[model samples]
Every structure is written in C-alpha cells, then in structure tokens.
Target chain A: MTGPHGYSKDKDAHLKRLRRIEGQIRGLQRMVEEDVYCIDILTQVSASTKALQSFALQLLEEHLRHCVAHAVERGGPEVDAKVAEATAAIARLLRT
Target chain B: MTGPHGYSKDKDAHLKRLRRIEGQIRGLQRMVEEDVYCIDILTQVSASTKALQSFALQLLEEHLRHCVAHAVERGGPEVDAKVAEATAAIARLLRT
Candidate 1:
C-alpha cells in the first residue's frame, strides 16, 4: 500500500476524535444493557450520531482536498465520477 | 498524490452505487418537500441509512484487505494505529 501523505498531523487528531467516539459507543452499549432511561440513552445515541456525522464530514472535506483534487488535476472522467460520488455521499449524510 | 491501487475495478462499482444513492436522496428530498406521509418518509430515510451503512461496510472490508493488511506487512505502529482507527469507525457505524 502506498503510504498516505499530506495530512499525517491532522490524521492523528482525527484518530483521537474517533477514539473518543469509540468510548462513547461502548458507554452507549452499556446503557442499553443496563436498561438505562430510554430518553437518556436516546440522547447519548443522538450525540454519537452527530459526532459520527461530523467525522464523516471532516473526512469528506479532506478527500476533496487530497483525492478528488488530485484526480481532477490529472484530468479525466475520474474527476467527474469522484465529484458525483462525493456529492452523493454528502446527500446521504444530510438525510441523517 | 499517489494513484490508488488494488481496487480500481471495485472503486468504479462503488462510485456507481453512490450515484444511485444520490438519486435516492434527491427523491427523498422531494418526498419531504411535498409533505409525503410521515411514515413513508421515515421508511425511505431508514432505507437510505441502511444503504449508507452497507457502503461503509464494503469500504471498511476493502480497507482491511488492502490498506490495513499492507500496513501490517510493512510492520510498525502504523498498522496498529490504522486498526484502532478502523475499529473506532466501525463503532461509530454501529451506533447509527
């Protein structure tokens, strides 16, 4: 695999955010298992959902900067395909 | 930027799937704008959510087979970090 370039520093920060989100999920699972208040569990679930949407958005932005931009510079249908794909992903994201 | 290797064929397929999902999202938007039945909108939204989850799972599996596995063969903390990141991403996906 080619080594990823261009965002190692920010990648680390993204990883840290993901780790915290991981912990939140675990806590959520325990909440469900323990039969915690339905509303309380739902609240945490909502927060986690938003957290994930935020992360996905961040990754999407980075993809545009790094992957899609590069593909466009090289020139071809690949660029249009990628932009369309990304737009679709964003549409999916907004639905949630 | 480096060209992506190992999944060009599948990548195209993924892009096509995303494009279809994009149309689905647009249809959902129209449904919302037209004030379609609440339950019907909710049902479509749920299907879209599952569709996104499926796409994410496919990408995650491919990443494990390609990226994470290659990083492991190369040897070092990079693999571990990647695996941790992937696990966290999976956790977030499940919460949804």
Candidate 2:
C-alpha cells in the first residue's frame, strides 16, 4: 500500500490546480486566435506565466522531499548529482 | 534496494545538462545586465526556452514512467488524478 509520500496523497489538489491552469491556457490560446489586443494578450500571458512558475515550484518541493531525499539515502555520487540537478532546475524556474 | 526506476539512475547526465543550461542562463542574465540589444537578448531567451522545454520533456518522461505508472498501479481515483495531472503538465510544457 502507498503512504503519504507515495505520489497518491495530494494528487487531487494538484489536479484541481491543473484544471484551472488548463482553463487559463485555453483562454490564452483563444486570445491569440481571436486577435485580441496585444496588451490584453500580454497580460494573460503574464498571468499564465506566473501560474506555471507556481506549479513548477510546487512540483520542485515534492521532488525534493520525495525524490531527492529518497535518492540521497542510497549514498553515492548520484545523490550529489541529483541535488545539483534539482537545485539547478529550481534556480532556472526562479530565473524566469 | 534501488531499482532502475529509482531517481538515482540517469541523474548524472541530467546534472550535466542542467549545468550547461545554467551557464546559458547566466549568459542571458549578463546580456540583460549589460543592456545588450533587445533582439540579442530575445534570441538568447529563445535558446534558453528551448533548453528548458527539452529538460522538461526528459523529466516528464521519467515522471511518467516512475511516478505516474507507479501511482496507477496502486489503484484509486487518486491514481487517475495523478495521470491526468501529469498529462496536463506535459501538455502545458509542449504548448510553450
């Protein structure tokens, strides 16, 4: 059976957020397709961008706790590599 | 014991790719700081965008195989939720 860290818990919450984001994305798509004002499209784009960044941050947190921590327990160069890689990914997400 | 699906596997390669992308990101930052031409910055931005897209694609593949597939096996509404969530994430990544 799966525990809290087993990717089962919290999935429903994630899905709801994703569905909302999906709606936002479709709205953006329609904005582009319908030749909306440039500033309006840009504003929607910025909102969508923030939504995606937030989502990435959430995923990064889960990955760090469940994936990276689990990998570190194995004790090897690979653990260090994963830490570095995940950190870099987080940094990249923050940079954008 | 860790198996092939464990996060440890393939980490080093991901780190190396991340480091290269980090260097590219830093370069972009420098360009912005130096007030480089707008087009030049935009071009670098596009490159970095593509790099991120590629990295996200790779991570999505791993997440699908290890995370989503594993979640599906446990059998619950949560499992379907996770699959839908991950699929939605991949779709968003592709859209951008």
Q: Which of the numbered candidates is closest to the native, going by highest lDDT?
A: 1
Q: What share of the true interface contacts does candidate 2 keep?
A: 0.00
lDDT (0-100) at residue B56 of candidate 2?
68
Q: Write the per-residue lDDT of candidate 2 for residues A13-90, one digit (tens) a residue.
A: 878888988999999889889999999999988888877876765676566555655554455676556655764674
Model 1, span B39-78: residue lDDT tens = 9998998888778877876675555445654565566677
What is the C-alpha lDDT profile of model 1 across A44-87, one tens digit per residue? 99898888877875676455445554554565677556655754
lDDT of model 1, residue A74: 64
Chain B TM for prediction 2: 0.75
After aligning candidate 1 to the native by TM-score, how far in Å is the CA of A49 from where it should be? 14
TM-score of each model, in listed order: 0.50, 0.45
Q: Give the runs in model 2 whose Cα sits over 4 Å from its true position.
A: A1-7, A91-96, B1-96
Pick by DockQ: which candidate is best? 2
Model 1 misplacement above 4 A: A1-96, B1-7
Evaluate candidate 1 and give its CAPRI docking class based on DockQ. incorrect
